[model samples]
Target: MERETESRVYGWEPGEQAGRTVGREYAELVGGLLDGQLLDVTGWTAADRAGGVLLIADLGLYGPGGRADYAPDDDDAAGGLFRWRGDTA
Candidate 1:
């Protein structure tokens, strides 16, 4: 008997329509804690991209520990993914 395996797709791959926006005009987070978060980078400068960080609310925490900071993973920034950095004060 032959067995079938499921295939999974990861990350974003631009299509023909994406050609209009060739640069980092927009960004979206994938994987880890901040998955699916979209950001507008149309006016973001080089410095902004280098130092860009995101603060996300951690539903798992309460009070002062309720938020965390995330920074774009340099390895995956070209693909627009942010990784959890640390908990915010």
Candidate 2:
């Protein structure tokens, strides 16, 4: 791409430049946390100084029935049951 066109997308405004390096590092760290070989799918894209990339990944598991179950909730927020056993955070 022409420098002019490239500049338009990756161009750093006055403040955005400061976060560029940090954001790239953070993305990498997140990608590293996942195990691609064990997982069903993994994807990545990146740019040089002007653009950023996102790592798309998934386990590719699903129920063919497409049925979901949920429990009723109480006002106290303690009575509700979680579907996922692990930490959502």
Candidate 3:
């Protein structure tokens, strides 16, 4: 007899670019923290940019505890460079 196993849906893998288009469209975090990190901005639009948006980043430091908040670096929003906002918890 075969034992039952659990299946899970894992989102973007580590170091994986979240966006569909690699370099064409995506949010990349620059500077000291989260540098070179790419995020999915598929549906993100100008309206969202005007209101400001917060993105959650998983640093993988200590599981969920390692997650943190980050926002677009307004100075370079067009460049898709984000800045470290603060810790999640």
Candidate 4:
């Protein structure tokens, strides 16, 4: 998964809640992506947690341009994400 180019990271606040299962899945996904060095990852943060059943994990990822623009509405094309579409995604 080593990317050809370097990537950045960004954080996101779902503005609601991700619970535990979803958060764990998300964390695992992110951790895998990061460990594999897949693409130019952005929005990565050590604070991203997924332990409790009712908590908010401020996750992160790289946007289209390799930056956390916070514009979750931005298209996945602009970011490296496959289904990125704001917090609702």
Candidate 5:
């Protein structure tokens, strides 16, 4: 059966000299955390820096949905629930 998934997208920007090195490191880190094989779904792109490479990664979490069922109040003094979620930092 199909299930709802949570998605987190991250952009890895490795400066001109070490794109390949950075890419391998990131793949290893994620593989270790999931304890499974990591597939290479990466695409080639240019970074903002001259001659840099950009790798975009999409991390998906699949399971029963509960976190998205509730919405946070955006009028909090601390600038909403996202503030603590690292969206502002």
Candidate 6:
């Protein structure tokens, strides 16, 4: 296996205290995502030692008009998510 010299993201630098089996796995996954061109991903922590949900304010490489001004679950039109607010909405 060759090291990908051209990897665009930062290398995985984990904290010194490896909490447990779950934490170590999470760290490895995050490292892979970052190396695979995940930009601006932050505040990622394992939830209850379970795999977490990924909320994207911007669709990014996933689709067109990729810049997200608000979170997908915000139910705001200005953010361009166009979530159904209510019957009046």
The candidate maximizing TM-score is 3
Superposed on all Cα atoms, model 3 deviates from the true structure by an RMSD in Å of 10.0
What C-alpha lDDT, on a 0 to 100 scale, does residue 8 get in candidate 6? 33
| lDDT tens readout by residue for model 4, 1-89 | 22222222223224322223212222212221232122222344423221111111234343233321122112333332322223311
Question: Which residue ranges in model 1 land beyond 4 Å of their true spot?
Answer: 1-24, 56-66, 77-79
Between candidates 4 and 6, the one scoring higher on lDDT is 6
Model 6: worst 10 consecutive residues (lDDT sum): 80-89
Residues 1-89, model 5: lDDT tens digits: 22222222123232322223324321211221122222222452222211221222222232322111111224444311211111110
In order, the Cα lDDT scores of the candidates are 0.50, 0.22, 0.51, 0.25, 0.23, 0.27
RMSD of 1: 10.3
Score every model by TM-score: 0.50, 0.15, 0.53, 0.15, 0.17, 0.19
lDDT of 1 by residue, 1-89 (tens): 22222211112243313222334345555544445555556787777866866454555244344655555677874746556665555
Residue 7 of model 3 has an lDDT of 18
Off by over 4 Å in 6: 1-6, 10-35, 38-43, 48-62, 66-89
Error of 4 at 9 (Å): 8.6
Full ranking by lDDT: 3, 1, 6, 4, 5, 2
Position 61, candidate 3: lDDT: 36
| Collision count of model 3 | 0
**Pairs of residues at least 3 apart in sequence or in different chains that clash in candidate 2:** none
The candidate that achieves the highest lDDT relative to the unseen native structure: 3
TM-score, model 5 to reference: 0.17
